[model samples]
Target: MEQRESGGMKILFTGGSSFTGYWFCRQLLEKGHEVIGLLTQKRENYEGIRKERVERLSCEMELIEESPFGSEKMIDLLKKGTFDVLCHHGAYLKDYKSEQFDWLYALETNTKNIKQVIHLAKEQGLGAIILTGSIFEQNEGIGNVPLRAFSPYGLSKGLTFEVFRYYAQLYNIPLGKFVIPNPFGMLEEKRFTFYLISQWKRGNIPAVQTPHYVRDNIPCDLLAGCYGRFVEKVFVQKGPFYRSNPSCFVESQGAFALRLSREVSKRSALSCPVELKEQKSYAEPLVRVNAEPAIFEVQEWSEERFWDDYVAYALEHY
Candidate 1:
């Protein structure tokens, strides 16, 4: 366990049970920051991967379970506790991928009591605020024309940032936007990587849709390291707003799947053969990725540890 000798800021964080949230908070803790995690659901309510995430986070830092963002419990904590940074990371996820996804509903929930949160941070002399952004958001990162959000859920995230940034600007608070691309590693949701491993477990080859879409995928711990470094630097910069779009493995989906398969082959007994389906659907952008490419190289010791942990988790859980 390593720790920073000085500048260990106290941070109020939400969404600790989320995949990236868990890694980001852990990185901060490893660097000696005090993290007070605010979990949206009661401890008992989380099941499956989310449950395991929460349990791991609980043993590491201060956690106020069932304390959703904008809830009375969170408001009370802000009023009573003096924090150096406020990190809002939670979001609504039901039907997030569908065209029927309600961005307005998510917008309302995401921004509820945002003004008060900013106000409290201002009064408490909080050094800065960090809000997680998605590259899928319209006009975010580098991408094809418009950079239109991949789905309604992405639009909601973009709007959510606007609402938070608006209030933070009003108070002249320093705000840091840490834009997330596709982060995959241990304790992640049952997404593309999970699907691949689970199919292998069933002795079936997995097919990748939207194989030609140029996207960004990075190890979660590496992304978390970026977040930790960004926070440490955000306070000193003279700014009303700052942002970092961390990118890694920026390539076509088919190429990325091949990279993943090769990596799995090196570390596990599974050959992990994958097929790339002819991409017919193009609802999302063909090129959408983070603005900052390779904040940390993919060849670090942490990246190796990432695969070790990831493959083990996949084999045991899938």
Candidate 2:
């Protein structure tokens, strides 16, 4: 296993049972870092854990895989232990469209769980908190973009970012929000990947609106590398606002985060420079190839205001 010679660090990931979560854990473990995983078993259909696979990938690192988001017992178990890092990667995205969107289940789950973890981190004064942010949470210009269709998911991510921001401000803790575009590759769920493979497996791939329009279509390997960097550099840093994609760290002593694209036409005390590499692709049009938008907005506003803008923009354009 390869890691910083300094020694091993204990890390906790809220969602680590499957897909990207599984690989994230694997990478951390490979780096000789200890990982305490929290798996929510709400999805009974896929209830069993692949212990064999986990044991194989875990290698030299310690892994305590269990559900720590549900009841008092679970929370107590989490609180009792200590972790150098606490990452909230656990999210419920069972289906693209569902009636449960009205309930705002993801927001409710993420907010409550993240609050608990943050409180615990504050109490322990752990490293930093890393929350996953999707590109969908961002605005897509003036129309009904495909990303805009992710209303419920976007709302949850927006709320989660706010919650982390508020807590970071109140407690004066180090924090980072990894706002990723579309990250795909290894440990990729066959079901989902198969769906895409099937689509492209056949014939002409229609290019939706050209891929260059998107922001950062990062690969999982690159994403894992980014995560490792965050865990090392930005985790213990002071202040807030660190974007993994464009690479900006807004420390407490620095300026706030504003909207910016690959090209910086406008400047503000709030904006920071971050280089983003673009990719090339011919339209196989399975799922908007290499689409990474240039503009990325960091910082926060009220949910009401966000919803208003989102709805108005979506209605007019979508």
Candidate 3:
């Protein structure tokens, strides 16, 4: 049954301070739903957004003021107000494996803390629980690949999805898992865009990596629209909606094909399948550019002027 978007949906969002969460909240607001955001603190940035929207910084929504981590105080907060939806979109993604502290931090934010929030929401009988997942979840480990590094961030996401799946079944709660691929666009803060542009400016990113191996780079606003579709599909579409090329065939062993498209394209050519040529690994990237209506079409990133185009996009948006 298609779940109609009811009026006045009360949503409790955790990790309102991050990039993904920021975009998610903007989408929610655009849908005309009432949202209470929980962030780490009332910093200058938060205050600015809050001033724009009175509800953005309400004490009821701002649980981070009392407790730094939402996992720690989720139960008590739920008891105060019955939320229609709970979104666990907070995560730590630093690009270093040797950093033991980063690993532990990722664990706390992704795994343990999420468990706490899920438990509390389940006990409270929330309408739906959505957890943000990543493409790295499909890989074996984090940041281990030579050209592509999954990082501790990816590992944490993998475990988080597993836990969410297990607990969703255990509690018999309606759940939506967004297996998001690489998302890029100008939204909320352009820190990530700035970082990419900076790398391009400094020639820090290699030419081989300039065009990105994956064509799944989506604009932030467009991504938000996709999230809205997923939310609509939570009850409409059967099971969890894989936020990827649903038509792309995968091996029975869950290894996706990488040779869907050709080696070169006037448009963007993803390294998705090219890089995996040497590894002979079970998991291979597939490009389904067969002209059929794919579940998801990779947005073509201009290869020749990728950096220039990317920088232009960021600057224009900023």
Candidate 4:
């Protein structure tokens, strides 16, 4: 296996067409690492947008169109490729509430894919594998919580983590896990923050059923920087790295909407009236874990600054 040196470690990144994957790859490239992005040929929604971004940003790195879950092909690539790490960011992301074929899709795209990657990593004798996790894996309630994923999407993520953990323990493979909070920045569309902003841009009042739900928002660039630092730390250390916190504070939906409204008004040529009307009750409090200190820490971005930057990016893009 190729070792980490000044030239940078060779890494195979799955889900290169994902929002998180796109930013993560950019960060790795900026840090002088050699990244080989594995992407599928088909394009849809966020994945399609992410794929375009990766193509636009990554000119030097090798972007291959191949299914990472194809065990035979992946094993062959692992054997031939001089890679130090395998970053698993690919998953079948769907709206857990409305999407059909929930469990079956999750099983194939998430659980099965992870198991194959683990076996291939071991066979290749790679240095380490880093996994991008989600806060949704936690149970919804007030205070510190346990791993109890309620929705199908959350359940998929939870199951994937367990699979990775199990293989890491049983085979003694080096692994790093980082659970990400709500990330906003470039190429982001249809998410809550951006969705609200878009509605306000059209001079319309947005309505929500759950205005009290809390979320920890992190900018995509900031999240990428943290992930880069974590990857470097994992390469240098001998033991596995496991961190649940991305060091973000929880903010309520009502607070977020108000702040966003303020930002929209400030940016508009004339006064942009904004109001969030409450409807039928379906609100649920989201529980986020306290951030534990890590080997590499990033300066947190303030909500105001984040909103300003987000609005600027949105205006330029949209």
lDDT by residue (100-192, candidate 4, tens digit) is: 537567757665545566666677777877877877664422344454654667777777777777877776767888777777777775687
The whole-model lDDT of each prediction reads 0.85, 0.51, 0.50, 0.68
Candidate 2 per-residue lDDT, tens place, 237-311, comes to 645666554322211111111121111112211122322223354222222222222223222223234334433
What local lDDT score does residue 71 receive in model 3, on the 0 to 100 scale? Answer: 46
How far is each candidate from the true structure, as Cα RMSD in Å?
Answer: 2.8, 14.7, 8.7, 3.4
**Model 1 steric clash pairs:** none
Off by over 4 Å in 2: 1-6, 42-74, 98-100, 113-116, 139-149, 190-193, 199-216, 246-318
lDDT-based ranking: 1, 4, 2, 3
Per-residue lDDT, model 2, residue 135, is 55
User: Higher-lDDT candidate among 1 and 3?
Assistant: 1
Off by over 4 Å in 4: 1-3, 42-48, 99-101, 113-117, 138-147, 270-272, 289-296, 300-308
| Count of steric clashes across candidates, in order | 0, 7, 9, 0
| lDDT of model number 2 | 0.51
Tell me the TM-score of each prediction against the true structure: 0.94, 0.62, 0.61, 0.85
- Stronger candidate by lDDT (3 vs 4): 4
Over 1-318, each residue of candidate 1 has an lDDT whose tens digit, in order, gives: 112257588889988888999998899899888899998878999998889888988888989977888888988998897888888888887898998999998998887788887787678677788899898787798889877888899999999999888888899888899999999988888899889889887788999988999989988888988888888777657478999888888999899899888878788888889999999998788999886765443234365677888888778888
Best by lDDT: 1
